[model samples]
Target: MPVTDVITDPENLTLTIHADFAAPVERVWAAYSDPRQLERFWGPPGWPATFTAFDHTVGGLAQYRLTGPRGEKSSGRWEFTRIEAPTLFEVLDSFVDDAGQPMEGFPAMRMTLEFSPTAEGTRMVGTSHFDSAEALEQVVAMGVIEGTKMAMSQLDTVLQDLRAYAQGKGTRLELLDDTHVRITRLVEGPRELVWRAHNEPELIRQWMLGPDGWEMTECVAAVAVGDTYRNSWAPVGDTPGQAFGFEGEALIIDAPRRAVTTERMQGTDGPTTLNDLNLYEEDGATLVTVLIEYPDLATRDMILATGMVDGMEASFRRLEAAVLV
Candidate 1:
């Protein structure tokens, strides 16, 4: 579901796919470099892949076999043509015989993988180039597009596990009172950097995004007492006039220590909620505590039922990577 676009261009003999992950570029790159991680999501659903041999350096080779549900197996190999750490790589992908030889008359494609940091998270752009339009169409007819989509969808689970491992522990959520909720996490970074990432508009846009395919289109923060902060977000692709955002006013601002704000959701007449953010350095890392006070218990329950906790956990994981790593 994180895959936003899949384009097949016959004129250029290329098949391109765009996927977004709620993790840093380094983590995303590791999913490809590490054979154990690569085997987790390298094949389509119901067809798990096992890597027989893997060497991730330039001119190196990788061999894998995907086993279908009905005891069927398909072998493949990748000849690494180029390697650029944490950003880009190129490979010659082809079908191989049981003896590890390239299959004759099968269409071999050149693949380029690109990883870049975006406003929300890391964007992976994969382009596969065939020798000719006929060859490209041949692969497309063989269900390559759908297979790729299903395979990439599995990355979300892999990324989530990687994030939890990197953060040391999962986020903690508690109901403080009938109308209050508290969330806390130990982030791997300095207090000042964590504070800057939350207060600065430019840094906020990079990690505050709630989910994949959504971006903060507008962010204006006035980080002083009585100043107002306004932000907006919408889908990143092709959907116009559909937006959800909020505006808030600063009530208390203590740089690198604490901040209090009153936030009102856009297009809603509900009572404004109070948000308190406190930061501290503990054992060379930062501890971020957020307390939310709703107008009533119903409002708090509604927010909790909306899965905001999961979304916030995803956002904070990105924040940890952007600020510290």
Candidate 2:
């Protein structure tokens, strides 16, 4: 295997490392807080890691189950000791058995991370202290220092993602329902095919609709921050529900992931009523969560009374067919 990211000093118990990355202090700080961002970047060159939990608070702990080079799954934990945002953090680190029971032979160590703000980005320093020189030697031999270095590099990639988000280049959650009903469906084809169907305007009309014969006549979408859009749904083959063409604001348009929000119609003729829209991916499938915080229990009752899930499911099935093609 290639050497771990650590530079070794063959005789000491104090292992120190200083590396500089090109990123801002705030962005670097965000990488520490966001676990999805962490998993995207932190691991060895070939050994990708998956995080189980990461709550970055002064007393919180971060845990990970990493698949090692030889396909062995190794677990580690970091208990945060101190945190001073955008500046420094310290934690107690340890390796453990499969169930997080402290291993009989594993040693606990203190790991401190210090951050220095710089023009290019931030300079990071890591210090690890073992209980004894022999314990330290065993850690080095077992590749702890290398793992630390690899983790740091992964951290760097995380900082880059934070920068992208700050620059408005990302898939961001606009709003989430305090209470929501998620509609999940397996598209007939690949996930990408399903996703594409949801995004195409032409296909959106096939599935998305109003009550009786209410058709989508016109629509325009702005898929990004600070972008507003509208859609017009007109009554067609008139049957039961015909609430004059609904149209409102695209308050949040995170199109990178095909999410949007519309300020739904009010009363039966007023301006808006509903709140937001969110889309998420799951294990080989996708979810659509519509967050509609009502003005009162009455409005909540109003939306739920409309059999919206039924309409939405119908739309989704059409979307499935369109995209699968």
Candidate 3:
């Protein structure tokens, strides 16, 4: 986690956060000024931010929304007030409606973010100035401190190149909590091709096979919301494994960008898992992120103990070798 200290001063009507990163000042500044990188860690876990508009000039504005796990949304805006390249910037932040209008009862805050070179790397200081003590206390009580900590912790991942950070790591899993786990893989391919490899049956059959000696017997991909998808696999001759499949309905689809689905094992009445898949492309490589919501800790452990990650890693390697190349 990059955040080292958080201070809330009611008398000063301010909340300040201090963070240290092992990245240079220019790199740290770029992460905040670039909308694509900013959205990667702008919101806390389970709630991801999407920036609709980003204008980084002194008088420009940025608009974004944080989408919750269940499709709920909270919109906000930032009016840039000052900029000093890789050193400092300031913005007027406020809650906004979907139409880009400021919310009625919410007050805006002036946020100043400063970056400085340190011996190790870069040090950041973020201060939010509120209109009154009441406003400062209001946001603090709403879990701003904890949310900011979680959000900033994700910056380390963004500060490094996706391929450098995740390629050799294969399919990695991070248990976000009792019910949520984040899985990631980096593939050397365009985002469009990666999306096609997942949705097109021909491409899927070429790479979705988990391990050697296994064949994908059936693949019915879901292309839109409410569409159902099923995929089955069987071991090849002399291979020792049982035949099984998974069935799911797509809950959301933003072709070549993101997809969310509910997955359950075929012929089972057990709890289902919500799989949210997101693909991001930088240069020619795509980072595939899947945020899964399990029912409970027991279910999460049981699924992971089934050698699921190993199978996923094998399939991803094949994806690059067979489908991507």
**For every model in order, what is the number of clashing pairs?**
0, 4, 0
Give candidates' CA RMSD values in order.
18.8, 18.0, 1.8
Report the alpha-carbon TM-score of model 3 versus the true structure.
Answer: 0.94
What TM-score do all the candidates reach, one by one? 0.51, 0.48, 0.94
Candidate topping TM-score: 3
**Consecutive 10-residue window with the lowest summed lDDT within model 2:** 167-176
TM-score of 1: 0.51
Candidate 3 lDDT tens digits, 238-272: 99999999999988787887788899999898679
The TM-score of candidate 2 is 0.48
Question: Global lDDT for candidate 3?
Answer: 0.91
Extract clashing residue pairs from model 1: none
Which regions of candidate 1 are displaced past 4 Å? 162-325
